[model samples]
Target: MMHPRLLATSIAVVIWGCGSAEAQTLVLGGRAGLTSATQWLNQPYFGYQRVHGTTAGVAATLELGPYFAVQAEGLYVEKGARYYTSYQMRMSYLEGPLLARLSWPIASSRYRLFALGGMAPSVELRCAGYQTVNNPVVNFFDAPPGTSPLDCDSQRQRHTDRSQVMGGGLAFDRGPSQVTLEFRRTRGSDIAGYDC
Candidate 1:
């Protein structure tokens, strides 16, 4: 969740009073965000807590008009879904998306109300550091977070992989500041296989 204060600031920039045309010609700025994302899983199978983390990164934008622009953003993301009885996992990936942005001006308002949709060729890396765990019971189940010292070590997975991403989001802008809420999905053979 973005803090209320920071949100207010972004909105102020998105709604900056009308600026000189040259000042509007090109916009170079950055953005940071938070997200609640998790693996697609069955709650009945894993009673443990879901994957919870934030994605904060940088972005660059080129405004083509009041209604259209091109955006390129790179975010280090943490994403996963949960399933099975012992679903304990943490993973992270660096994703770069090049997308087309569509925007609209609010009626008689300084802020621009916009919807963004685009395609991103991306990469999903497998974070590493999962250890060979000891199975105490004759009936072997996966490792749990509390089973042993394996709990003390964890790292983001890194590997060679890529995918296609699609997402749509809304943003409010004034001038140099903006607040955006968007959802994007990425899929590749990597998302399906254990090696990815």
Candidate 2:
């Protein structure tokens, strides 16, 4: 007869050993890319244009199998929008994304095509606004009665944002390194102000 506690412990150890043999591989990487961002403002009356910026980050990928993986990234991103000719706003953020990726190789080649979908949560670090004064005298004083000056007054922007990310790109895989190009769209809740 065997002790129940000893039998249970042995069984647990065997299961743990088996699970360890099939553990996912963790790969660490870094990425740098350009981004075009625009604020989805509630006020549609204000025409917003895309603002170009840069994104750089470190990423960790957990390879679950030949076709499936999960990736997480920590990045610094700049986002904002330009309204009309004189007013523009830029905001900086620290962003993190958790993404699920599906990949397939091309006929046993070193190149792979992958698609990723994810959610990114970001914290705003700073926000700034700029305006080009075409005519100082005209802007300083409303010389002509209905014409308004350049509204460069800063507003209190929200400190946090969350966005849904989706995109696909190609990757070239080397021994321990890979080069990838991806285009992703990020849409989300309003960053500031109430809906109009």
Candidate 3:
């Protein structure tokens, strides 16, 4: 659950932006994209690899001027990493990003270039892992006496994560509609047991 103060602050920002008369334009749109996510682990024994996922969301932008805007989004994002040879972990979250955007038009206002920097707060919806081991083990300390190494799956409950996001993109304007191509990087918070 989100803290009440955080929720109130978010609401205040939105209300202030919309209430300002200097906000000359409002753009509302939806976006979908692919994400390559991986964990940054400090453990020497664990080598994490990127895992591909999907992200989709709706965005709202309040233009403060010709070159400045405040944008916010509500998105569903999938993030995780792979370790060892056949072990994988996955986490899904509902994320919200608040960004400051700067844009300028070029080539007779048909093309626009923009850059954005933001912070995203995400709440975990699900977490799971997949592990596969071929060698059978019977060590009581780590497993039951007769326990055998086999494919296994498990789920975990985790807390919310806050990430730093920054990116740049290009947009093409056609009358009232615009198309954008953006590239962004999201650096997630470190887990308690994970070093760095």
Candidate 4:
């Protein structure tokens, strides 16, 4: 597997090249936003709540034409769930998303309505916070109870994840650059280690 850093650099280089000619435009920017993240647990044990966190990233977009574009981003995301207000789990990740986007001008104005959907591959950087232990049935490891402590272990969790990304938003043209307000959701596709 390619290293995450190398993969990010590769994406940037490709985006730069794609934007250099043929009436293409390159838009580079930073992103800072709020995230309400949660995990889906298959077991009927714990009730999960959305955990609030911050998301920040850098994005490179290559506009192929007036209506279509390709975007690549490198982000640090905090994702996890809160368990009954007593415990909050936070898992940090390095994520790379490559998306295909479509945009349309709103009545020939500077405002545009856009929608984007794509796949994002991510690596878990760390896991923190608390794990609630009630009856203590099967732990995250799926081992016999008591064999594994109820603690945050990054290694025990899956290191890599494949996710689906879907979002839509409005964009305002600003000369050579654009300002956008977007709403996006990313969902994990594979079961985490032993649990979903």
Alpha carbon lDDT of each predicted model? 0.55, 0.74, 0.75, 0.78
* Candidate whose lDDT is highest: 4
In the predicted model 3, the residue pairs found to clash are: none
Stretches of candidate 2 off by over 4 Å are 1-23, 42-45, 131-157, 194-196
Q: CA lDDT of 165 in candidate 1? A: 61
Ranking by TM-score: 4, 3, 2, 1
- Ranking of all candidate structures by their lDDT, best first: 4, 3, 2, 1
lDDT of 4 by residue, 65-149 (tens): 6777889999999887766645666788899999877788899799999999888999988776654466666657533443434
**What digit string (tens of lDDT, one per residue) describes model 3 on residues 25-69?**
778999799999987667687668988899999999777766667
TM-score of 4: 0.76
Reference-based lDDT, residue 60, model 3: 91
Give lDDT tens digits, candidate 1, residues 31-80. 56654554332445434345566676678877755766667888777765
What TM-score goes with each of the models? Answer: 0.59, 0.74, 0.75, 0.76
Clashes per prediction? 19, 0, 0, 0
Model 4 poorest ten-residue lDDT run: 141-150
